[model samples]
Target: MKRYALQPLVIGALNPESPVSKHRQLRAILRTHAQETCKPGDRLPPERELAEYFDVARKTLRQAIDSLVEDQVLKRVVGVGTFVAHPKVDLQAKLTSYTEEMHRRGMVPAARVLRFDSVPAVGNLAREMGLAEGTPVVRFRRLLLADGTPMSLDDNFIPEHLVPGFLDDEAPMSLYQRLDERYGLILQWAEDEIEAAAATVENADLLKVEIGFPLLRVTRHAYVDDNLIDFSVSVYRSDRYKLFVPIQRHGMRPPRYTKITQT
Candidate 1:
């Protein structure tokens, strides 16, 4: 008996006369099936097994798998067979920085400066960064790497007035650490909204995921007191990150009926 259960493969049949290549269609099918059934840390069938099962040429199957890997749907191991990547999570309870989180797990954290440019703020983006409309704001976009492998894209917007001379300061490895040490800026709290999305062309290339692959988009505003300090949008490889929220019960139940307020 096979130890690993054979999941029901759901590859739809190719159009007999469509212009689209069968290899491309196979890639879509496999990607969809993996999204529906596989989570981070799941192992996929070997290339030979997948090719035999699909009755396609090895080249065809390899092409499909390669597409999936690029989209970040699947990841390949060096010597071992490819396994699903587990989504990373924050082990610390207090709101923490990505650099600190990765360091806690013994992973090397590095950032590649993709672009750093200053532009006039406008509309809600300006409001979120606490800049007057048309006021200059600095935008920093980086590809975050863990242990030399790409995992996420961080795009941060900051009001030019808040961090003076920020452009000259080669952003340290850890933004939070720098905020505390250099400028005496203390990061107190942040508000975050998380949603799922497909990797677009830009995100696909930056994250090394296939186009249209699933990802987690987190939009956040970090604040110091009543002033908004930074607005960041982070897109993470869904296969490489798992968001965890712990729930607790206080054993308090709502009253069966509300008591009238006394004057």
Candidate 2:
């Protein structure tokens, strides 16, 4: 098999007299070169060549690369060379399924059902789903993928009565789509709360990241016609995903002005 190499556009040499450090200058130069010349998933040149070309020590070159990796501008495989990173997915605050969101971004979406079974609702599950204790509920654990890369681990719970035969093998990739098409239960609205978390050992393996990496935990409650229908806890890789919320000032009372009395 032919191996492809990453070729950054040639740029001016770094200025030693400048205030900026050499490593920082190298990082900036490489970032611009990568953005201009390399596509996502393009493999970078060997470390030795890159270091020699920049006339910097290997340690300094590695530092620059590490910074880019942390910023998600580049990705480093253990044995493989570094590569350009795909743009992070911006998740808007909206009622949409993972499949729909990925499709809108022109990326292929897939799901692997890690666990699907009927479990009795208890504790917070019962309270959140508004179901009696011991009521049957469909539990779905799925690994959501985009463009063949794992994006999130979703644990979803829904009232079993609302979705019959949900444990079958032929489950759809999009739970919302299945609900609407099979059970006529369309999601009307949802509320989500996002917080930063550390990836656990199990989640790290599933998400292909190192343990304790930063992650975004999103807790969601979906409703249909004012009835709580589904609840889910999804953990997303913070490096590959971001949440976008639009904020605007509304309903603020204008400054009260008193009419000035004529003298």
Candidate 3:
């Protein structure tokens, strides 16, 4: 019977005489509580205690909590009760490396290289990288993580000439940084096509999500002096990351990048 600090804010706030619906009011109150008072993983008061305090039925209380859960502000565990949810990282359309972006978000980023090898470029990949068919390409698959939690599964393809001697042991955490320092290849810009898809069994297994879970699929084509140099496809856990376009992409402060200092 530990008391939740948020319960004080909720007391006497469900004005039944107010024109607003009680459930809606309660939902707003809870949202405010979450933003102003609660941190991620903070346990909410039991449903029965909250319902009794609000003088509303359990159904109304549940309705309010349900909306917050759908919005990703709250999470429910069976037999465990509700808790504040960890914030989702927005996939901002900024031209920064994943390591740099994760640093900006105050999360540690790492890559677990699942597969790495040189292969012949096929029809679409050859055309995409502006290379002749059957050209040697270096392809690597990696499980990308933030704070040790799997966030994305990636397949990065590059013309072998672009990254000579690139091996699994020397795979870079910040590809952009490696390209700059090791190969002296300055990345110009990249274009991405994003879509939603269901996770495959392999993707589910690697990302630690249930099979058929929703994922954000991003295909990127990177350039150097207008020459396409790299093509990569990344599948991100939708529950952990959501994509967004900023009102202004340019003139923003550049990220403090994380270098390829780890194995």
Candidate 4:
């Protein structure tokens, strides 16, 4: 039999005489356990073992697992076993804080500030920054790092009127954090688009990846109170990063499949 540090909470709440089905109660408890403790890709006990431990029929146990699998909270592999699914991305549009996203993945984060200067914005950059065609703006370039490894390169332009002391201070790991903490720039909302492209020769040299490797490019425009505050272009390494965007469809359920086996 497979062993686990199975918590008592998983089976402690069942009432043999309750109105609820024992299978239902067991399913609820197991779902809670996975949410609170299990890492993505962690495997659960086999169906037979769970059925025996919960004192439920095999059919009942299977039904409970199936429901959770549909919820995207759990997944089963045919030849292996069920596991917690890694996060998935949604095609629907949304905004995200890069700092919070990286920290959640258990990576040590850092950023290298390459250039910080107030210069005359030109062409479309001035328009994006909500300035005159050649208005002065702060241009910044940074290399975002995870676990001391280069993961992405970011370039941003902000109107000088919005961030007064931005160029004076040394940069931090997260520009968003610094904006709110230092300049009192409250970021109300942002719009962004993501796409895939091959790393250019310059990008490959800076990111330490092979030239022409696939990369994820994200372009963003951030705002505060109907005012355009920042515009940025970021490029990320494809091999080192996997994006997870959760989604729910309107009709039929999504398919579930497993990819790993346990010894």
Best by TM-score: 3
- TM-score, predicted candidate 1 vs. hidden true structure: 0.63
Q: TM-scores of the models, in the given order?
A: 0.63, 0.73, 0.77, 0.57
Q: Give the clash count for model 1.
A: 10
What are the root-mean-square deviations of the candidates from the true structure over C-alphas?
13.5, 10.0, 6.1, 10.1
Runs in model 4 lying further than 4 Å from the true structure: 1-97, 242-263
Note the clash tally of each candidate. Answer: 10, 0, 0, 3
| Shift of residue 196 alpha carbon in model 2, Å | 1.7
* Residue 21 displacement in candidate 3 (angstroms): 7.0
Model 3 C-alpha RMSD vs. true structure (Å) is 6.1
Worst 10 residues of 3 by lDDT: 254-263
Candidate 4 displacement at residue 20 in angstroms: 35
Candidate scoring better on lDDT of 1 and 2? 2
**Candidate 4's error at 176, in angstroms?**
1.2
Candidate 2's residue-wise lDDT over 86-141, tens digit each?
Answer: 77766665677888888987888899889888999999888877789999988889
- State the local distance difference test value for candidate 2: 0.81
**Per-residue accuracy of model 3 over 54-126 as CA lDDT, tens digit each:** 7789999999999999988898989999999878875465467888878987889999988788999989888
Candidate 1 positional error at 233, Å = 0.4
